[model samples]
Target: MLLVRPPGVYRAQEDTSLLRQVLRRRGRRGLVEGRSVLDIGSGTGALGIEAFRAGAADLTAIDLSRRSVLTSWLNSRLHGIPATVRRGDLFSPVNPHRFDLVLANPPYVPTADRPPSRHRMARCWDAGPDGRVLLDRICAGAPSALDEDGTLLVVQSGIAGEQATLDRCEEAGLVAETVARARIPFGPVLRARVPELRTRGLLGPDQVEEELVVIEARHG
Candidate 1:
């Protein structure tokens, strides 16, 4: 489906495609058929749209940027998909409600610079120091936003500590594990952070590929 991407809205990337494929597999297994799905950080509304095509009954998409909100909303309309797209930071707009599936492709690219970056474009990819800013938040608060049988599918870079995310999810009362993974060449952001990542021991001198993992967490 064609998508509208306004300036500052994140472009769906490889990680996004990976998660969508996983969602399709889950749907084939009947896990997502007729389920309600929430797409946190719903850039371009791509994931939410996929959820509908995958047989989900409803979709609610949230994003922090107004541009992203507009772009995602427009894309949903473009595909004739119905989505309740809202402008708000992670989970805020959906308070007091829960869904069967929560999808997230949050900011996981690490940066030395303090995040929630003032630079408009950087906000889409800049996670605080260790790149756990939004990921950590999602892990901790997902349960509250999920129905009893709900599942959370989140993708993050290995450098951001995949194990850390699993542990956090487990501690939050979720049974979590790495459900999918892929090694991708460094993107422009990672390429620019080579020196900082090396210093932080997240990247080796000769390492050029970053492993991305899709973590699936279910209520324990």
Candidate 2:
């Protein structure tokens, strides 16, 4: 699982690993076999590569950063799998093209910053105030991007409101729920935002850990 992770590009962390585990589980259940897969905000392209190995018939990955797109392409090549990697905002590059599966590990850190930085590194994790900038967009666009029976597996921090994600998907005509969850120690970003998050009522005083959840949304 060696990958070329250039600086300023996101390095796979606990959330990434959790998403990978879910992908593997779904693959084992034959959910990903011969399906078209889309990996949004594809950072290092790890999830797309996993889908390819799991027998995805077609795989496309999109990212907002050129470095991330290059990294994804390189990693796909390293694994001898062909992936269509493009640089653009989420779902913009592949509009009107529906997929059987969509995977995302988007930026979900609640930041006080009004708008997230355009810097390559900061773009990886700085979602605005409530951390739903991209999450909300994904939920809104997922129904249109997915085939009638398609499924979406997206991971986000519980601090960002897991129920909101499920509600958004449901509103979009998908059945959504938390499929997996983990309690992890706050990362550097969350640790630094403790005071602000507490003041915003998003975090409890003395809370040192955060829960991460993998949301599975399926079109009926």
Q: Which ten residues in a row have the lowest lDDT in candidate 1?
A: 111-120
Q: Looking at model 2, report the run of 10 residues with the lowest lDDT sum.
A: 114-123
Q: Give candidate 2 misplaced runs (Cα > 4 Å).
A: none
Scored against the true structure, residue 146 in model 2 reaches a CA lDDT of 94
Cα lDDT for residue 102, model 1?
98
Which ranges in model 1 have alpha carbons more than 4 Å from their true place? none
In model 1, what is the error at residue 125, expressed in angstroms? 0.7
Per residue, candidate 1 scores C-alpha lDDT tens digits across 70-188 of: 98899999999878998887888989899999999998878777656856788888888889999989999999999999999998889899999999999999999999999999999
Q: How far is candidate 1 from the true structure (C-alpha RMSD, Å)?
A: 1.0
Candidate closest to the true structure, highest lDDT: 2
Q: lDDT of each model, Cα atoms only?
A: 0.90, 0.92
N/CA/C clash count, model 1:
0
Summed backbone clashes in each candidate are 0, 0
